[model samples]
Target: MKYAILTADEPFISLAELKSLLNNENNIYYFSGIAVFSGDYKNIARRSSNIKAIGEVLAISNDPKDINEVIRGKCFTIKPNVILRSDKDRFNALYSTATKGVIFSKKCETLDLIFTDGIIIAGLREEERDSKSLLLHAKKPYSQSGTMDAYTSRLMVNLANPKKTVFDPFVGVGSILIESAWIGYTCLGADIDINMLEKTKYNLKYFGYTCDLLQSNIATNCIKKTDAIVTDPPYGKSVNAKTIKIEELYEKLFSISSEILSKNGRLVFATDAKYDWRDKIKEYNLSIIGIHFIYLHKSLSRAIYVVQKR
Candidate 1:
């Protein structure tokens, strides 16, 4: 069935994250801010961090009357939500039909009435979640000083779409792994630092989730590759790869990844280094599908890369 994915505040990143979670399925079409795609219910029903809402396409037009009239024929015992593009006022010739339903009840359906770029679409909503509460719960009292936030970590795991298991080569304080485990993915993490691994253990226990974390070098990963990998490796800050050539470190990373990742397995990671490694990725039989840059400050920025074995 065709579905509509409502994007978050940052439309670009949200759209990219959603597309990746959909396994890079670019059958997506956009008229208004809503993104439309086709997928089975089992694949689409799973909760995703980037998807604000899901709906079935009902009609596409500039006039609200056209949308409202379409909904009128298929009456709902429940009043589905009437959400508009950018929360626009729901009116114009279809006021009577659009205003015929109750809200804030046990009803689970939604009507996405959006207007953007001179187009409007009406869709039947399926699911919605409380992102704020989830984030608040993730922001536990215990946190690493420079580790990635749980929200971004969750986004990365979501983008990777780990099926049976997920791994992290450099799981500092278990930020990504914690989020991955919470999402019900069998998680495994490795780090060269013993202290960090201990902290990771406590962090996972704090969240009432357990993960397999070991103290191992990235160049020699003991854990077998699984469905997906999400990690944040140190690039230039403390514990940087200064003892060895940065190029060599990256080479080993991709090489081991190529060996460990199963077919169709995804590896999503972030680094601060600004270098073109397309040739290196190709050498390892991997292809980079998506990359996003987060500008944190004037001196530093993070580049997120999503790649899969070719």
Candidate 2:
């Protein structure tokens, strides 16, 4: 069994991302902030933005015998969770269970156990998220007023379930492309403005990456096939779409994506919550897999849509 301790913020998006990347979705159980599921734990953890820690589940049972079997003769520590936080008696009982043939010290602990949903889950933490690297959006070599943040960029790419290649039609400063390349994908980016393409190139080069860059419009039909199309198109006054309206741009994107994307390929993009593209999506024979909303403030909310070609 595998386990993932997810971040508490916007957990629905985290769940959607985990579900998209992992198989055997039916068996996945989420309790509190932890997710118990079956998949490639290392692959999912490396690409994940919301998963804090992931590893194998050694023991999962309410009975102390099950817990004792794993903790005995091992140096471990018990991490507090929602259950133990509110119930002191439960924490004491758990501490007593770990003291049997076990040396418990915070500094000397080699393994960790978390009690949640009336059960103790003990495991060897294989990977922990790099909090500093995930917040390095501002430190990029090139950035503009409206460049997407690193966390959201990685989340959008993961929602696409990308295999080998990821394409971003409106690759402003290569936000999506940067995250995709970092996650071991062949990145391809295109934008109508030559200046923006140059900025993307400079930023990607700073990170020691070289991706295929093109100066073209979103309506272009000559682009090569890609496994996933992940982008954040021009939106609001911060971005200027000179040639076509935003609605028309999405329609063209949906139309072109249906033709160029590989079989069952995903087109993951973000737009304002006010815009409705269901009609356009249907007209292009695409299927809507998921839509997650992130509220910016009282007046604005961003809608992320995950659509796949049939």
- Badly placed stretches (over 4 Å) of model 2 are 63-65, 77-79, 83-93, 96-100, 105-110, 239-243
lDDT of 1 at 189: 91
Candidate 2 lDDT trough over 10 residues, lowest sum: 78-87
- Residues 245-298, model 2: lDDT tens digits: 888888889988998899999999999898888778979989999889998877
How many clashes in each structure?
1, 0
Local distance difference test, each candidate: 0.71, 0.81
RMSD of each: 3.6, 2.5
Determine which window of 10 residues in candidate 1 has minimal summed lDDT.
77-86
lDDT string, candidate 1, 279-300, tens digits? 8888998989888777777877
